[model samples]
Target: MAFESFSEFLAMGTHGPYVWSVYGITGVFLVGMVLQTLSAKKKQLKRLHSILVKDVSEREK
Candidate 1:
């Protein structure tokens, strides 16, 4: 199906709304998951670093 113009392509013969909505939702999910995973990793690393430092200080004492 050849679209006469860009707007026509977007309309997608009346299926555009559904198609575009699904794409938008999927994009949000992917971005949200990546951010959440990174945040969790950063927190874990910080906690581990503090624990290691405490252990080292105790050994010196």
Candidate 2:
């Protein structure tokens, strides 16, 4: 498809909003998933560290 002018290209034949919104939502969802995974990993590591310390202390006594 070829546009006669720049404006026509941006309008995208009146489907611009729907097409752009899909892309935007996809990007946001990907970013959110990454952040959530990182925080969960941090929480898991902290919990594991405390559990290991407790086990070592019990064995000493």
Q: Highest TM-score among the candidates is held by which one?
A: 1
In candidate 1, list every pair of residues with a backbone clash.
Answer: none
Please give, for residues 1-61, the per-residue lDDT of candidate 2 as tens digits: 5889988877789998987789899999999999999999999999999999999999999
lDDT, residue 26, model 2:
99
lDDT of each: 0.97, 0.92
TM, every model = 0.71, 0.59
Candidate 2: segments with Cα more than 4 A from true spot: 1-10, 53-61
Clash count of each predicted structure:
0, 0
